[model samples]
Target: MNHEFSIESRQFNLWYGDFQALFDIDIGIRQGIITALIGPSGCGKTTLLRSVNRINERLGYVRTEGLMKVMQKNILDSDVELAQLRKQVGMVFQRPNPLPLSIRDNILFAHKLHTQSHEKLSRQDENNLVENVLRQVLLWDSVKERLHQKAIDLSLEEQQKLCIARLLPVKPSILLMDEPCSALDPKGTEAVEELLWELRGQYTILIVTHNMAQARRVSDESIFMLMGKLMEHAPTDQMFVTPACKETADYIEGRYG
Candidate 1:
């Protein structure tokens, strides 16, 4: 029951009907640090992130085994509410998917859903909340004057930042990012990477990325996975310099994924 790590997966296994996606994944993701999950396609990087938020269960045939805990709660428990879990663990997808609403509304959307219904969050309170989160994601200055604009109208980088901003008002402890910068150009990628640094130590971030350089730049710790199995987990510097496993070394050297 201890919240030992921001997220803990002990002997976790996952399957899609007859096909297995993950095999006995055991990892202790330290609190408030960025951990990168790097692997080739179909290596279950995204599957692991989705599992923390129970997004995999949306599929009828999906089944899981072993313990997967987020903030000390076993999310696989039948009694756990998806909404409550999601409130504690937010996810940013590979693409920015803002609702078809104004920038302000996009930021306010989750706060409204999770807050007590009877409590009237004053207009000022809502405005403050929006501004605070926007600032957290480093988007306040650029979009501050365009709060009423539709989120879709913004540049891809801005929309991605807004997606991250929206998650903050919910007070999430864990942030799961699945290749969050894949859609951005070089400049946009750099901007978001800086924002990720800004967010470090404030929230536990688990990012799945194909870009090895990006992972090395943003993550304090690195986890290498291959063919649905964990190859190695180590400090970012050690992982890059002296990988413990041959598979890891191969992957690091740009060999077969």
Candidate 2:
């Protein structure tokens, strides 16, 4: 399927004070598809992901240069609202990290924050929102009877799905996942992988992963990064079957990390 949204970065650079983390990098992420960033640790995969959502700009002494645009809006622009950008592009971390509240409250948190922007959602609207997103993630059946229970009470996999559910109420245009399945067990990983496929039609997804198999399974396009530079990027099947770069081939063939 073709993407409806587009993301592009040109000569993007990132630095943590005197230390540079990302080299000047250029890439484009097609909307409505899963693009996976794969590489060894500290190679700037996460940094690139953070830059897409402008998360890196929040750090003190961190500086960015060049241009980053999402859906034609320049995210690097000074006038851009980081909060609003974050709402349009939601993120999911490696760990569950659900709030210390009831399941219902967790899903409603984003809605409550922007209450004035949206008409006051009646209880039924809230419930429908929760039910729809939960079902999309295949978690509603498991948690429906326990909506009032503490979020911490759910299983680790269920908690991760709940976090995903929380993002849906705000209707984000893109989903950024940073090693979302790294903390999961085999079963939990499969759950998240299945959820990703289910969500591809509704939102553009960009994921950073160290798991090559996971990338092969879930991503339409795969990007390989090494030492702060892009090594190779291609359709998932082609990349794994015939990597264009030696480093990418080595990594995928289990020759080296």
Task: Report, for all candidates in order, the number of backbone clashes.
Answer: 0, 0
Give RMSD (Å) of candidate 2 vs. truth.
2.0
lDDT, candidate 2, 33-77, per-residue tens? 999999988999999999888887778788988888887888988
lDDT of 1 by residue, 198-230 (tens): 999989999999999999999999999998898
How many clashing residue pairs, candidate 1?
A: 0
- TM-score of every candidate relative to the true structure: 0.98, 0.95
TM-score of 1: 0.98
- Angstrom error of the Cα, residue 114, model 2: value is 2.4
Model 2 clash pairs are: none
